[model samples]
Structures are given as structure tokens and as C-alpha cells.
Target: MDRRQLEYFLAIVQTGGFTSAGRRLRVAQPSLSQAIRALERDLGTPLFDRLGRGVGLTAAGEALVRPAKQVLRDFATARASVESVLGLTGGRLDIVALTTLAVDPLAALIGRFRAAHERVDVRVTDPELDNAVTGMVLEGDCELGLAESPGGVEGLDHLRLRDQEFFAVLPPGSAIDPAHPIEVAELAGWALVSTPEGTAMRTLVDRELGRCGAAPRVAVETTHRAAIVPLVLAGAGATVLPPRLAEDAAGRGAVVVPTTPRLVHGAVMMWRSGQLSPAARAFVELARLDETALPPAGTAGPTRSP
Candidate 1:
């Protein structure tokens, strides 16, 4: 019913209870409850079902979630527009990136953005799934999202940033020669330190290995990106990684080599197709400039919804 009520409602949803939401928003529990009650009354329906020590969204609440978030996002954008006159001296940019791409490109991209707008706070989160990036941006949970291009959602605009090349990383003292590229078939029967199934990297690895009449013998399946290289180094198994990460693994005594014919995917930056907050706009411009020096890949430039 109001911005404050919507904020309180979303906070409760995010933190999973009124008590935790109160802690997060620094509002007293009674006041937070009163705000939600007022909102539910105005909407003519109860938003949440009372559960012992916690809460669950009612059908009405579930329906309001997306629009509520969009309203808050628009309000913030409106404020940001007025604040733009003060320059990029202060603001916050929220971004969600695919777990696999977070380190290689997102880290460097954030580094450059911070160098220019040092006062702006940048927050980055990883999506639960590869396709969830588009949903997060569309629902206004994030101003920007980085994921594999040819996004699954339709209401967002995309900028093709760069192409990431995958390589095979083997443990120390492996018989493979670093100078020679290996074929996908050769990796068959070997244990692999892999991310869980359905991840972008895992999908690519599976498809490629499947082509060679083999399936991954997953030695360790984990969501922890940082542990992959270490596991490979520990001789858990070989894993596929992007070039930047593979290079780092090589420096740490892991044998890194390119797969024959090469495995590559296009990394993209995506946003809702509407007015953007100043910080988000500046981040997009920064990406555009960064892309200019690199060779073009899929889509060639920014693409928008019809």
C-alpha cells in the first residue's frame, strides 16, 4: 500500500521472519507487524499466514512480491535520478552474476568501476541457477546481471561482454604435456572435480564429453568455485575451467591445457529495458568501453527486447 510497507514486507520475505526482518531493517517488531497489518488491510487480503515463530506468504503475498519489488526499485531509481546531479560521488550498485563467471570478468569489471566511482558501494550476489540471473533483474532484485548470453528471459536488454574459453586442469605430475591440446575423448574414464549438474560449466562439460561417447565420472561435486582448483591439485580429479581461472591453476602447479577444438561461451551483462539508475548506467557504459578493445563475439552489441 505504501513504500515503507512494501520495504517491510520484502524484508520479512528476505530474512524469513518478522524478528529477523526487524533486526535487518532496524525497526521494532511491533512496528513492523503494524505496517504489514496496515498493508494487508489496504489490499483487502491477508498477505502472510501466521506460523509459529515464522511466517509464510499467502497467495496474495506471493502475487504481490514481484510488483512490490518493482515499486521499490522504481522509487530508488527516481531518487537516484535526482541525486545524479551530485555526480557519481555516492550510490550503490547491486549486481548478480553467474557463479562461474564471477571471478574472471566480474572481479576485473568491478575493479575498474570502483576505480572511477570510488565512493559508490557495489554489491554482488550469485544467482541460484544460470537462468535465474534474468529473473532477478526482471523482478528488480538487481540492477545488473552477468550471465551467459542469449538470456532465457525476454524483458531485459543484454550487452555481449566477452567470450570465455574453457580449459582442462589436471593435477601435478600428470603424464599429459602442457604444450599439447587434449581431446575430449581422452578425458573419458578419468574422475572429474565438477560443479553440480545444470550449472553452465557443468552443462558445457557434459555436452562436450557426451560427444566423445563418455560421461563425467564426478569425483567431487560442489558448488564452491574456489575449491575446484584446489581439489584438482589434490588429485581429486581434473576439471574444466575458463582461461583466466585455468591460468591461475597453472601457476599453482596444476597442469592447465586447452581442450582440442576449444570450449567457449559468451558472457553478457543484462538489465531491465527501462530507465536505469545512474550507477547502473555508468556500469553499463564502463562495460561498453571495456568491450570496444576486444574482438566481437555473438550478437556483436547490445540487444533489447521488442
Candidate 2:
């Protein structure tokens, strides 16, 4: 059968009905039904048994389902591969994030990658809008997506390659007993400057705060990680920050305190196997920081948050 017929058939199987399948495929319902019928007739067997409003895949149809999906996926992959060769390192590069990742190693990785793949053009999109990114990737609008781990995209492979833990950024010269790491309730004593209350990272922070028997005293809330450092530097209050974002702040009078419940943040790479741009694939491979949090580049400085 032609790719069009194959695509319609697969859509039908995936959506579990002719109408829904046609909607997803963006083809008229009758047209999709006709294509499926043509495919079944050409194969000389009933592909699906229509029982009332529901339909079940027949033995032969079940057999075709797996290979059908592969055919469609492979076809899309081939198209992307061809397009990639024509441009960025022979393909296009696009990215998405969740605010947190936009701040740190993503820039580092992109800079290093562009230096190596000078011919490859890369475009970085705002990290706030992930739904659009996922939709585009699924529809082959972009070559790759970087996002939070635990994304629920079907039919795509996601590789989680980087991780960082939450560290409390203490205000410059604020005194905390060095013997015992501060508890959450004690943390509440400090004016709290943090990300917005309902954000993903904030939610995790709240949960951990509850676990440690303390409620955060809300002082200043912002989505900006860079702002967190200055707020703390001005003695606004303590806030949770990733180690990389708090980098070298100790010298600037900021203390990175490690928290006990370990609020580690992670980044995942999402891409389907196909023809991929060398730049995109390299970013995926090289961008994921060592998931294993290593010893810091220097000796014990201001202690990281518990």
C-alpha cells in the first residue's frame, strides 16, 4: 500500500476509531475510511472487525499494526534526515526549556557546540512553552527538544543526561551555626526570596520544606534565578538555587547551603531516532552534564546546602 494509506491505517489503529484517526491525520473521515477499505481489499483480508460503534483489529490487522507504525515513523525520520543534510551541519536545531535550564550549562553546551560545528545553525526557544515544543517535535517541526525529565510523549525516546541538587543560597555574611545544617523551620526565620509559589521547582521546595518541619516564610518570589542571587546578596532572605546558578557566589558573600531532603533538579533530552543533525545530536550527547554530581572544581569552599 502507498504511504498515505499506510499512514491513515496507522492513525486509525492509534486513535482506536476511524473518526478520531482521521481527525489526528487531518484528513476527512470518509476519506480515511475509504483508504482503510482500499488497503484491506488490496491485502485480500479484513483488517478490522467493526462491531457496532467499536472496532477491533483482526488477526491480520494486528499483524500489520506494528510494521505500519514503523513504516510511518521511518518515513518521517527519513524526511527529517534529508532536510537536516541540506542545512544545519546539514539540518535545523531548536530547543525548549522550563525556565530553570535556560540559566546554566545549556548556554555552556551551546557555546562549545557552535564553536565545534561552525556550519551548524542553532536556534534556542523560550523554555516556558513546552507544549508547543512537544507538538512541533511530534509533527517534525523541529529536530530536537530539551526539557524536564518525566515528559509524557508517546512514540519518542527521551534521554535524561544531567542532574543538580537544590542548595540554599544564604545572604552575604548571614550567620548560621556551622555545626548543624539548618532545618526547614529554622530556614523560615530568614526572609525567603524564591521562585514563584506554584512553579515546579517551588512546589518541590515546598514539599521538602514540609518534610523538614518548616513552612517557608514567603518574602520575594520570582521566576528569575539570577535575581535570587542579588536578592540574597542584599540580605533579602535565603532561597533555593541549583549549584551551578550559585557558582562562585561564595566569594561574592553568598553561601550555598546543601539541604537534607536533596531537591535535585534534572534535564532530559528528547529526540526520535532518525537522520539527525550532527549539531543537534552532539548537543544531546554533550549538553547533559555528568548526571553524577562530582566533587566541585575546588576544595571545600562555603559548604553547599544540605
Candidate 3:
């Protein structure tokens, strides 16, 4: 019936119950129930069927879901369009990204974006697991996201930034050949220090190893990307790293070897398929500019892994 009512309705639908929806919306449960009742009265039909533990959308409620979502998206887009005309004065941009990506292209893009629009404030949330980044975006906690492609969410759009190449991070002076790409089978022989289970790198490693019918002998597991290097340096085991990081580690005397089959994965910038706030749009534009002007991957000098 109204924007607030639509918001309450959608929240209930998404969260699957009135109590959780009320908690999420930060409103009293009674008030949330009243609002939904009001919405149902306006629609001339009950939107939800009460369940033993939760609620389910009735036929009418199901019908309202898609349009309600679109309406909310359109309203946000309209507000953003108005804000864009104001030239991004004191706008804020929220972003969620993977740790490894936050250290590279995302960091650079944020720097450039800030320089271009001094009034816009940017906040970045780096999650170790890739899905958390997508979750942040999907839940409307962030306006922008940078991570591996094929986010698998409907109504979101993304652009490929680059194919991030993964390299083997070996101990200092390891016998593994640096000049040639190491086969997955060969790398599996060494006990590996790996990023923890949920990270993109770990997923990549497991998928590749599984495809090869081999498994890594994981010696140590860590959540922090930086920790991988020190463990490897201490000869804990070899680990995989992205190109710039590998290059920097190599510069620091770590044996950086390319992987066999060239373990390259795509990184993308993703946003919902509606209007972005002026600041967010500006940041996206800066990212686009950076992508065009930047040389092919690995062309820029190595950035030392911190």
C-alpha cells in the first residue's frame, strides 16, 4: 500500500517469519504484524498463510513478491537518480570484497576513485570467504562487490575485470622449477600450506586437484592470506597465491612457479541491476577507466605481499 508497508511485507517474506523480520527491520513485532495486516486489508486478500512455526506466502502473497521487489528496486533507483543530479556531494559508497582482491585491483580502484571525488566516502568490508562478499551485496549491505565471476544471483549484473592467475608459493630455494609451470600432480606431492577451506583460492585448489583425481597434502591451513607466505617461508609447505603477490614473494626470494594448466580465474565487479547512487556509479566508472588503461595482467611491477 505504501513504501514502508511494502518494505515490511518483503522483509517478512524474505526472513520467513514476522519475528525475524521485525528484528531485522528493528521494529516491534506487534507493529510489524499490524503493518502486514494493513497491507493485506489494502490488497483485499491475505498475503500470507500462517504456519505452525513460520509463514508462507499465499497465492496473492506470492504474486506480490516479484512486483514488490521490483517496486523497491525502482524506488531506490529513482532516489539515486535524483542524488546523482546533485553531483555526489558527500555521498557514501559501501563495498564488500575478498581479502586477496581487496589487496590488489580493488585497493587501487578505491584510491583512484577517492582522488577523483573527494567528497565521496568509501567503506570496504573484506571477507575471507567469497560467498560472504556476495551475501553482503545480495542483502543490500553494500552497493558494490568485486570477486570471482558467475555470482549465480538473479537480477545482478557484473563486468569481468581480469583473469587472476594463481601461482605456486614455494619455500625459499625449493627444488620445484620456477621457470616451468608445475603440474597439479607434482604440486600435490608436497605438503601444502593453504588458505582455509572457504576462501576462493582454496576452492580453486580443491576443484583443480579433484579434477586431476589428486588431493593436496595440506600441512597447514590459515585464514589470513599473509600468513600463507610466512608458513611457506618457514618451509611449512608450498601454497598458492595470486600473480602480484607471487611476484612480490618471488622478489623476496620465495620460489614463485606458475601452475600447470595456468590456474587463471576471472574477477568481476558486480552490482544489482538498478540505479546505483551517484558515488557508487562514479566508483564504477573509475573502475571501468582503470580496466581500460591498465596493461594486461602481470604487466605492472610486482606488489610485495604484505
Q: Rate the local accuracy (lDDT) of all candidates.
A: 0.85, 0.67, 0.80
Instruction: Please give each candidate's TM-score.
Output: 0.93, 0.60, 0.72
lDDT of 1: 0.85
Off by over 4 Å in 3: 1-83, 298-306
Give lDDT tens digits, candidate 3, residues 163-208: 7778888898787656666897777888898877878888888888
How do the residues 1-306 of candidate 2 rate in per-residue lDDT, one tens digit apiece?
A: 989998887777777888788678789988888888889989999999897776789999988876775666566556656765664444446666555566655676678777766776677676443445555565554556665557556856777655656666788666664334556556667778877755646766777778777777878887675677788889888877665666555557787766554566566667755545555666776655433443432233344433
- Point out where model 1 deviates above 4 Å: 295-306
Q: How far does residue 165 in candidate 3 sit from its true spot (Å)?
A: 0.3
What is the C-alpha RMSD, rounded to one decimal, of candidate 2?
A: 8.7
**Judged by lDDT, which candidate is best?**
1
Model 2 worst lDDT window (10 residues): 297-306
